[model samples]
Target chain A: MINDNSEIILSVRDLRATVDGTEILKGLNLEVRAGEIHAIMGLNGSGKSTFSKVLAGHPDYEVTAGEIHFKGQDVLELDPHDRATAGIFLAFQYPLEIPGVSNRDFLRVAFNAHRKARGEDEIDVFDFDDLIEEKLDVVKMDASFLDRSVNEGFSGGEKKRNEILQMALLEPALSILDETDSGLDIDALKTVAGGVNQLANADNAVVLITHYQRLLDYIVPDFVHVMADGRIITTGGKDLAKQLESRGYEWVLEEFRAGVTA
Target chain B: MATVSDVSVLRTADQRDAYLKGLVQIAQAAVPENLALEEVRSRAASFLNEQTFPSTRQEDWRFTDLSAMLAIDFATTGEASVTEADIAELRLPETAGAQVVVVNGRVSRELSQLGSLPEGAVVGSLGDRPELQSQLADRLAQASGNHEVFTALNTVGFTDAVVVWLPRNQVVETPIQIIYVSQAQGDSLLVQPRCLVVAESGSALTLVEDYWGNSTATHFTNAVTELWLDANAQITHSRIEREGTGTFHIGKTVVTQARDSQYIGVAAGFGAKLARHNWEIYQTGEQTTTRIYGLGAISATQHADTHSLVALSHPHGIVEQEHKAIVDGKAHSVFNGRMAVAQKAQLTNASQLNRNLLLSDQARIDTKPQLEIVADNVKCAHGATVSQLQSDEIFYLQSRGISAPQAQRLLIYAFAMEILDRIPVETLRSRLAEAITQWP
Candidate 1:
């Protein structure tokens, strides 16, 4: 869904972040514009996920030296929830299981919180029910999931689909899918990726952080970036994901180190 | 109003132990005319003669310190000065016509709204109906744990009690309620509220005993409730304690279940400066079912303790118990669950668990599960857990646009709702849920 030269939704410059006082993302740079889907591919500990967490203002991920601007507003001063209301959604890699809270109640509360933040009238239970039932079709989820506890005893694929379902309901401008394809089977992955593809319009952008190229087939990306040593080493088109699939990440790391030394 | 001599008598109090003696003496002033009632009162008086206020050295009172109550020379008798309008909000709509109101331990006939009792069903004070007097003669103050200190204290002093007696195969469709509202008038008062319920064979009843108040002054309330269940009978009991601020509340719920009977109890506490509930259930019949659940949500220097015991004597019985507490600020909570399975109780299934949520660093929780099994072929399991809200769970909610405080409220509500949702009355459940929502 790449449109004409669109508005820049997010811009991160020299993003240096740490977790537990240990540096994870060092001098990372990323620029995401509206209507563009970017795929960040890397091996373990390469700081791709850290970049997403830091962008979302996670309490533990400290941004010691970085500049993150969402729609030209400084995101560092806002709280985590404020960042969410500002249209930055980070789909968790490992969704948490919360017992005793029904899925429908949790979604309703989340939706009402957003509405309250925008000074709009919050939707009641009956109206929200209609809205949620319509949104459930995007992820192909059964209505029974609405009554059960949030993510409790849910299958891995079910949990992944729930994350995408949230994306559909929220309609965020910048969605960071952190390994949304990790736990899904083929059918579930297709459904979840289709959800993401449908939500990405000319007004919003999507950032996918994954280790495999299988998800890229369902949701085509406008650009493919390889990350090494906490920074993007290479940026290319969709064919770059095919190249990384054929040749593993070792060659990219080797070339990155070679260039660093030279 | 207390006479000048009564004030002089209360000034004789020296220590906390002397405070107990003075209370027993003051409660002994009124004597029942019924010979059977007098005999029960004298028997409890003898038991209270050798008993004193429990100390921390005692195992039962280890975590609860009763010294705070000793500072007040409480009057055993006070003029109940409450109007029906004062208790309007405390009355439940579900128990409209079937509710009994007791102010300062005396039944207010003007305030009680008793529906038409079916044939052979009685709902009133001890002397409300003379025909059933003989039937309840030997049944008064005769439960297994009647000899306990506070239980004897209530027996020695309570002026009036709400009694519900049903004949064989009788069924009460409405949930009967006994509302005890406390108010410390003139001076610090000691109000002893008592209740007795007997469900005969093949009968079923749902009972709710609500202790409510909103006064800022302190009061001492010692409440005792006893239930006798016959074979093939079913009973559901809900005991809710929300005394006024700075009130010291000690309550006991004793039950004896016959064979093929079912008893379920849900005890919850929220609004006392210091509160303790002793729940004792005994299974005398085989093929019985018992479930006990408790919850305490307190904060701001309050202390709440619960002691429960389920003793199984017959074979083919089942029991399940769960206790939870949400302690915040400097508040402290204690839970002691004991399960005893005798040799005759073969093929029994029993399980108990205590879960606590500590919301502040200074808050304290002490929990213990004691199980004693004498039967070799029985199944018994018990466990306890004390925890703080998980950071990851809060972060998950915060990422969804909920503020940190609201996220915390949601998590705490979920934790406490695990037990509160099981309360049988819908309005009561929602009211308590709303209280938990607004709890600091």
Candidate 2:
């Protein structure tokens, strides 16, 4: 599905950002195209999550210098919701528990917001119910989750599935899944990965951020990236992920250090 | 700021006694010739003579300043006509036939729609039913409730009182509704509305008391409601205070629970320049249960206060209470919940919480959870919190494509819905929710 004629969904050049007066993402660059899956692998403090948040326009991350272009349109000036309605989706690392807002209501409001942005009429409750039920099937979710408050009492696995369900509903062109497989059991991870695979198409792309390579086994990525100290140190084909899996990250750090010295 | 300015507003002894004595005279003039009510009015009138207008100097009225009421002169309910169309929107379809409408504190028979009642169940004015009238002489205003100034004033001069009585083991199928509307003619009036409910052993019923101002005239509404639950009886009550902006409403709801009886009350206040609700519950028997939930949403210069007391006197008593306030603009909201566990009330379990959300920098909130537990074997927990909307919650909503302002509205709705959901009537719950969302 990697077509040379496909348009680029996301292009970040020299992105520098900070939070609470501390620089986190420093001089990072990346590019994502249509129908391609890229896995950004890093250690816990390698700034992978901060990169995803900055791309999604989180308020806390102040981009001091950089340019974010989505479909050749500058997105750094956009608000988080405006960016979301402009077809960029970020699955949070920890989904919030809204105690009184129903899941069905939340999903409908989100869907209608996207619809309004697209100049389409908002769907009624009955129609939205059918639409959400269909998307729930993509994540193997039960119908009872729609009646409860949004993520109020959900387990780790259920919250992940709910996020995926929202992604399936919004149908964004560029998706950033932030640690979607962290808290899931084997079965839940497979189900979540299966849903992502089902939604992948030639016109859409996904950027997966994870600390482990186990998720790449189910949803094969076209590129695997290794990040360190707020920069992507090295990137390679899918085989590099396997090599990094067998030979620990310290080996790559030493090799990187040698290359830098030479 | 308000405390400093209110220092000079305190009334002298002559002014206090004169203002209260004037109100007592107005109430006594409206008193009917019924012999059954004469004794109650006489006793309350004697008590009201020595009382005066409450000021900010008093402990109970510290955060509440009633000096503004000194400027207005209130009259009796003289020929005030309120048609059905005035209260059509306030009526709930759930209580279609089992409803009574009180206009200017007198029963408006033309507007009430009490279709039918069971053989032992009675729902109507207190004077119409002889059985309730006989019980009213002994049961009304019997509890040692809070704010004696207002309750005694209402008992002395209320024109008519609504009564709900259920015999032993007679469970009413339909919920009883009492719609109290106030309308002033020519001048400002004092709308004193009263209600009494008695549930015998093994009987159960749900009651809704709605206080709605039907006119734009400035008025003073003093309301009092007394509930009695015998052994094994249950009563669920919902009190809604959405008075007019020009009105000042002060109400008292007192309850007495017998052995094994349960009482659950949900009250919400949204309107009126100054509104206060004194809710008190007393336990007389063992194994009694009480649940209270309250909410007040105010903006602009409005002031809303709720003072609640739950006294557990018997063993194995249980209580749970939660009160919330949403204050915006320069408005003020107060909540003081007291839980008193006596020595005889062994093994009592009680918990209380008061949470306030200040939406503006100028808004004010005063909340206190007082626990006085003399019994060493009892379990009691109390807490209070004052905060604005969480930044993370708003961002979480915004991340989902909802705009910031809409996200704030959604969060406020969610915060208040916890108490609004306890309302038994579907129409009533939705209406109150809508009002909160539409609050300015």
Number of the predicted model whose DockQ against the real structure is largest: 1
Provide the global lDDT of candidate 2 against the true structure: 0.88
Q: Write the per-residue lDDT of candidate 1 for residues A129-184, one digit (tens) a residue.
A: 99999999999999999998899999999998898888898889999999999868
lDDT of 2 by residue, A109-203 (tens): 88998899889999999999999999999999999999999999999999999999999999999999999999789999999999999999998
How much of the true A–B contact set does each candidate keep? 0.65, 0.55
Q: Candidate 2 regions off by >4 Å?
A: A250-262, B1-13, B127-132, B214-216
In model 1, the runs with Cα more than 4 Å from the true position are: B1-16, B30-36
- Candidate 1 per-residue C-alpha lDDT over B263-308 given as tens digits, one digit per residue, 9 for 90 to 100: 9999999988999999999898999999989999999999999999
DockQ for each model = 0.78, 0.70
Q: Give each model's clash number.
A: 0, 0
lDDT of 2 by residue, B1-440 (tens): 54854664543546777888888888878877662476777788777776788878798899999988877788885687788779999889889899999988988889999996678687888756545565676688777772399999998888788988899999987888899988876757798999989999999999999999745668899999999999999999999998998889999999999999999999999888899999999999999999999999999999999999999999999999999999999999988898899999999989998989899999999987889999899988888999998877777777778888878898889889989999998999998888877776
